[model samples]
Target: MRIVVCVKQVPGTHDAKIDPETKRIIREGIKVVINPFDTYAIEAAVQIKEEIGGEVIVLSMGPSRAITVLREGITVGADRGILLSDRAFGGSDTWATSYALSRAIETIGDVDLVICGKQAIDGDTAQVGPGIAAHLSWPQATYVMDIADINSGSLTARRMHEDGWDLCAVKLPAVITVVKDINQPRVPTLKGRLAAEKQEIPIWKAADIGADPERLGLNGSPTRVVKTNPPQGRMKKSVVLDGPVEQSVRRLVQELRQRSLV
Candidate 1:
């Protein structure tokens, strides 16, 4: 089994500034960290590798600084890391980002499984993983909570739904987006950290992965953010009442009736 986990480097703070001109988050000078949800995805992939006796490869696409996230993954047991970095990849939306990642996966040759987090915290758009599956024309399961079983060519997983979870079986070479309920991420050991420091992470560009220029970067994105602003704050006030239990109940009911809340 050769499992690939897709990780992302996201702004560590909620107060990250957005570029008004481009309508994208300004990444430079912002504190960066691995997307919190992606840690579960990495945990799931590492667990699968341990059970099946295979290698786990971590893949990330971002600016040159994003290499830190890849190295962090290596420290946590990923056998290898691949960084897709280039100026041309700037301002890519989910669609173009997935297209580029799909191309890179193809370049990596054979892969048994792909896993990713349900969403990135910065964007809060859970689209990239499914987008990658669409580009690869493979089966995908989103919001996965558990891997029930896996063999040589097939896997059974528990997918989270609104009501509960559904068990689904998929062939090898499938993609899955995992939620934080999957598993707890392991801490990097001393040996793993040393190994990661010495590892040479291969970098790829749009051309290296054979991605079409017309289908990559901002130009290829079908959606665009025209503008963004902080949400308005609520200004409503609440009233406090003190009286006997029955009087208090009556007052509450009167307030509800006054506000048409019941």
Candidate 2:
């Protein structure tokens, strides 16, 4: 049960600006924290490892500064960390991003399962995990609410949907993206923090992972943004109900019926 968990560092504030030219979030020099959702994936991986007895390795892709989140992962429970960083990976979209990640996993070689958050808060596309599965030609279960069981060769989890959840099972070397509902993340203990301080994380370059140059960064991405803008704000209205008790209730009912809110 060698579980690999993918985590990310996201802008800590809502004031994060976007690059107009590339249509991507501007991340340099910003205060960042681990993506909230990825914490659940980390917790899930740790729990699975605790149950089955194996190592939980955390991985991330970003600039050198993104190592903060990987260190955080180690402080919680992961055994080690790996970073995919290089100027060559700049401006990559979900497709290109997943390509590099899958290649890095391939370089690592004997991974049994890959886990990730349902989505990154900054991007919110929820595409990278599935894209990595596709690039690796592995089975994937997205929006997972819980891992029912996992052993040497196969795993089972509850997949979230609009109406309900489904019990999904897949073979080893599969990818799964988990939602925050899966579990509460454990705080980093004194020993864990101390261990994190001594760990030497390995950083991988594009060539180190055998990633094709033609499939990285902006040039490798097929999707293009014609324009980027914030969504228009919605106006709010207030109403007051003042009358005899019966009259007020009747008026409210009528208003609700008229607005089709009932």
Candidate 3:
């Protein structure tokens, strides 16, 4: 089995600044880390590979510095890493981003499965994984909490839902977005880190992945951020509801009513 795990580099801090002009996060000068969710995806892929004896390849699309996350995946267990980076891929929305990633997967060829995190913290849209599935015209199971079974032809996964999870069986070459509940990520050993540091990850440009020029970058992005505003600060006022249980309940309700928060 040749499993591909998709990872992303995201701003490490919650206080990431937004570019007023572009209405996008200003990533420059800020510390970047692997998306927390992607780590679970990596762990899932690694476990799958270890269980059945196959190779796991980590893939990402971002600036050159994004290579760090790819190497990080390698340190955990992935056999190799590939990066998709170029000026053309700049400012790509989820749609365009998934398209480019799908193209890269096609270039890799003969892939058995693709796994990704449920969402990226910075965006939180949770659309890219399904978008990739759509672009590839393959079956997809999102919010996967576990892999129940696997083989060369198909795999069974437990898809998480609001109430609970249900088993989903899909054919080979499918895509799945894993939730953190899937597994705990393994720490990179010193030896693994050294090997990852020495590994040369190939960076693929738009042309290398055969991505359509018209379907990349800002021009190809169907969605645009018209404006952005920071979340309004919460009220700092506090109320102490003391006395008997009924009194406290009544007081709380009164306070809530006064604040129009009931």
Candidate 4:
């Protein structure tokens, strides 16, 4: 089993600003951190590798600074890391982003599984994982909560839905987007950190991945953000009434009814 975990470097602060022209989050100068949700994916990949006796590789696409997140993955038990970075790869939306990653994965050769977080906090679309699967033409399971079984190049898992979870079975070479409920991510160990420091991560560009220029970066993305603004803040406050418990409940219900909250 050769498992590849897809990770991302995202803005660490909530105060990240957006580019008015592009309507994309302004990344320059913002502190970058590994997407928190992706840590669970990483953890799941490591566990799968440990159980199945295979290698785990972490892959990410971003600016040169994104290498930090790849190295961080190595420190958390990934065997190696790959960074797909180039100026031409900038301003990629989920569609183009997945295309780039899919190409990179192809360049890496044999892979049994791909794991990713359910979504990135900065962009809550939750589209990249499935998009990559589409590009790779592989089966995908999103919002996966647990891996029930893995054997003979097949996987059985539980996928979370609005009402309940559904059991799904997929062949090998599949993509899975995991939620935080999947597992608790572990901290990097001393040895893992040292190994990560000594590791030399390879960076790939569009040419390296044999990507079509017309299908990558901002130009390839069909969807564009036309406008962005912070949601207006609420100004109302709750009032406590001094009365019997039942009376308080009645008052609260009446207030809710008046406001159509129910």
Candidate 5:
């Protein structure tokens, strides 16, 4: 089984700049961390590999510095890493981003399964995984809480939803996006850390992946960001509780009821 996990480098701070033309985050020269949710995807892939004896390869699409997140995945048990980076990939919306990723996966050859986080904190779009599935024409299950079984030809997992969750089975060579509730991520061992430090990742350009230039970046993206405004500040309301605890609780409940908070 060859499991490819797609990870991302997202801004660490909430203060992010957007390209008004593309409606995408300007990731250049900003402090970044591994997309927090991607860690779970990495963990899930690593765990699956360990359980069944396979390789976990981490993939990412970003600038050169984004390779850091790939290396981080290697330290936590990914076998190797690949980066999809090129000037043409700049300012890609989720659709374009997912298309590039699907092409990268195709370049990697035989992959039994693809895993990713449900969403990136920076974008909060939650569309890339499903988008990749669409581009690849493979089955997809999103918001997966736990994978119950995996075999040579298929996989079964519990998919989470608004009301509840249901077990779903899909054929191999499928895509799935995981939520944070899946598993606890393991820390990188000293040996794994050393290996990650020395790993030389190969960077693939759009041409390298045989991706169409017309569908590579901002030009391929149909969505545009006309304007972006910072979120308005929320007003703080202070409620003072007086007298006994029970009285305070009652008063708070009454206040909440009045405000339709309950």
Candidate 6:
């Protein structure tokens, strides 16, 4: 099986700033790391490869500096890494990004499965994975908590939801976005790190992937970020109840009633 795991380089800090002019994250000079959720996706792919014997290829789309995340994946068991980087790929929204990635997958060919994180922390739209599926006309299962079974033909996975999870089966050549509940990521070995450091990751440009120029970047993106604002700070208040247990319980009930809380 040829499994492709989609990874991303994200700002390591929670205090990432947004570019007021572009309405995008200001990534310059920020310490970067692999997307936290994507780590679970990588772990899932590596586990599947270990069980069934296959190649695990880590793919990412970002600037040349983003190669760090690709090499990071290799240190954990990905067989190889591919990067999509070019000026034309700049300013791509989820739709354009997924389209480019889908094109790259087509270029890779013979891919049996594509695995991705439920969402990127920086963007958090959670649309790219499903968008890739839509572009490829393949089945997709998102918010996957576990993979029960997988082979060349199909896979059975548990999908997570608000209430709980449900099992779903999808044919091969499908896409799935995994949640952190799927697995704990393994630490990289010294030897693996050395290998990753020496590995040669090929960079693919937009033309290399045959992505339509009309749908390549900012101009190609249909959606626009009109505005951005920092999240409102929440207020916190606490009261202490000291008395007999019954008395405290009654007091708590009265307090809740006063606040219109059941």
TM-score, every prediction: 0.92, 0.91, 0.94, 0.94, 0.92, 0.92
lDDT of 4 by residue, 209-260 (tens): 9999988888888988889988887766859888999999999999999999
- Candidate 6 per-residue lDDT over residues 29-85, each given as its tens digit: 888889999999999999999999999999999989999999999999999999999
Per-model lDDT: 0.91, 0.92, 0.93, 0.91, 0.93, 0.94
Q: Candidate 1: worst 10 consecutive residues by lDDT?
A: 233-242
Deviation from truth (RMSD, Å), model 2? 2.2
Q: Give the TM-score comparing model 4 with the true structure, all chains together.
A: 0.94
Candidate 1, residue 67: lDDT: 88
> Against the hidden true structure, what lDDT does model 2 obtain?
0.92
What lDDT tens digits, residue by residue, belong to model 1 across residues 78-113?
999999998788889999999999999999979888
Clashing pairs in 5: none
Q: In lDDT terms, how accurate is model 6?
A: 0.94
Candidate 1 residue 78 C-alpha distance from true site, Å: 0.3
Better of 2 and 6 by lDDT: 6
* Model 6 TM-score, all chains together: 0.92
Displacement of the residue 92 alpha carbon in candidate 2, Å: 0.7
What does the lDDT come to for candidate 4? 0.91
How much is 184 displaced in model 3, in angstroms?
1.0
* Candidate 2 TM-score, C-alpha based: 0.91
lDDT by residue for model 5 (1-262), tens: 9999999999986658876665567787788999999999999999999899999999999999999999999999999999999999987888899999999999998998999999999889999999999999999999999999999899999999999999999998899999999999998899998999999999999999999988978888878777788798777767678789999999989988998999
Ranking of all predicted structures according to lDDT, beginning with the best and ending with the worst: 6, 3, 5, 2, 4, 1
Tell me the spans in candidate 3 whose CA falls farther than 4 Å from its real position: 240-250, 257-262
CA deviation > 4 Å runs, candidate 2? 236-262
